[model samples]
Target: MEEIYAKFVSQKISKTRWRPVPSGSLQPAETFATGSWDNEENRVLLWSTGDLGNLDSDGGFEGDHQLLCGIRHHGDVMDLQFFDQERIVAASSTGCVTVFLHHPNNQTLSVSQQWTTAHFHTGPGSPSCSTAPCTGVVCNSPEIVTVGEDGRINLFRVDHKEAVRTIGLVTECHSTVWIDIPTSSTL
Candidate 1:
């Protein structure tokens, strides 16, 4: 039987993602990233489970839940998807999308580029009394796509700092998963 275990974290968890082990790399898929929300010190953390069974003499789950990195972010992380081993796209409640680059050697992650207010509560980059949450995000290499609660779909390119195109008035979208199947827009 598989044994189930749990770890107590300090904040509300919003998203968790597995760090992809690149092809032919002599590494195991045991490290992952966790994004937290609604805390004064909201942060994204990297964790590892490879040392679960490799405990120290004290038997306290030594080095198993070790924190690789904890970086502060602007708002509640709603979604995150890794394009590769080193890059990730994250959507937030602030209606923003960010591109992060992870440095495995130093166990650090940094925001490389950001599209601020990709979807507004009112409209594209528009001001409102409150901000709408970005519902989801997906990245296929150079192309990063995001959906938001304001009924907007934003398309971004890696080389570009802003979204190149947007589809709006989507009637309060909660999520969007990009599939390679052929299709056309209904709007």
Candidate 2:
């Protein structure tokens, strides 16, 4: 991480605009989807750091293009993970999972695809189908595994007609994965 100061100089106002400005310093891990892990708060602080230099002095960040399509939840993001580097998933405390796909025009950026309720608490012992927040998510091949606060694991199928193809209870186990591999036999 680099420690630098940001200062603005005005042409008309000389001494008035020439005050010492502190840009502070940013930590190494505070980049991209990575957020701050404050030991004092115990809970992680998530932030979407927009590009600074890209913004004009007129206070307008929008130029000829916008990368983010939409923001689903304004609340604190519980966790984040990437899938195949083409999509970004942000799980919120409201039991909603926001999936962002790579912008079709620009493969380098992302745009929100959808925000749906994750059924982390919608099964056998669940009270009113009110879901719990997703603590973590893992993707491997055609399957996505999401672990929630209610001690349940939801399995999702990627290339299927239905998005969430299965729902089951998990006990005394960590997680599961589905892999695809082809084999060839020659004579």
Candidate 3:
């Protein structure tokens, strides 16, 4: 039989990703990340489903998912992706991108790097700058790519504070972005 568990978080969840497990490892994925949207205060959170091996009399796992740690996020959390086992990358509606580091020793999350105003829009004859919402983010370890409502794509390195490259799609806007990594070469 299958089992299902649900939790009522006050805010609407925007994204969720399971922490990647290493190959040849006997351990299963016990943790995941979550991002929230349309709330007074948005957040990026880590949760643990507890030990799945510990089953109760009904053959269901004991306990619900527990919040491990969380951090406040600027604007709505538009997109979220796990960079690796210990790092999470998040794109926000405020046109900013952030990388959060998870410390297992303390069970805490912290901002490791951020790019402010990574995407923006300017109106004709308007002196003020408006921030564009970063709609999606994808990660390939050190490289992260983000797409925004302003029809712009930005490529960033996790260790750097500035974007490595930017591509503007003048006539189009995007809501999601993805990455494809080549595993082998064809002769």
Candidate 4:
């Protein structure tokens, strides 16, 4: 037989206070243009690409060359794809997907459109992650294909937010993408 002893100890420690972004930034392009995971001020940061831009650390929309905005998604962004070099498609772990357009001239990132009703699942029975119903998405021109852990494949068309058809399930769908290949004759 073995005996075990348990004890508890308490200690106090001091942590240093740090800040984000230097006191003053000059270069406009140095700003960020993607989603963020910081102190909740902004889920996204859009930097400038031109001359001195006016931006409020509190999110003030000022110039046309300001950082592009991100979609106000309900979940963490897992994958982001830009379509036609103008629209941004973001996939989240919560099975929610969104599309955003570039408002370059607006001087602020704005949501041109979104498709929150589209729920890509990772499992069966209501698109939950535990089931892995729909886990990933891929786009090829006019089409977007989604894969899930539920052994199912769902297809949709661009500009049209509704699912065109549901291809039978294909398990363990982590991600997908389209590759352009020439036909044998063309090759």
Best by TM-score: 3
Question: Which ten-residue region of model 1 has the weakest summed lDDT?
Answer: 178-187
List, residue by residue over 131-177, the lDDT tens digit for candidate 4.
Answer: 23234566666776665444556677766757788766444454443
Location of the lowest summed lDDT over 10 successive residues in candidate 2: 11-20
TM-score of each: 0.83, 0.46, 0.86, 0.51
Give candidate 4 misplaced runs (Cα > 4 Å): 1-33, 36-68, 120-134, 172-187
Of the candidates numbered 2 and 4, which has the greater TM-score value? 4
Please, what is the whole-model Cα lDDT of each candidate in the order they appear? 0.77, 0.44, 0.86, 0.46
What's the C-alpha lDDT at position 22 in model 2? 25
Clashes of 2: 0
Which structure is stronger by lDDT: 1 or 3? 3
Error of 2 at 22 (Å): 37
Q: Is 2 or 3 the stronger prediction by lDDT?
A: 3
Tens-place lDDT digits, model 3, residues 8-107: 8887899998887775677768899999999999999999988655778988677568899999999999889889899999999999999999998999
lDDT of 1 by residue, 89-118 (tens): 788888888878888888898988888878
| Pairs clashing within candidate 1 | none
TM-score of 3: 0.86
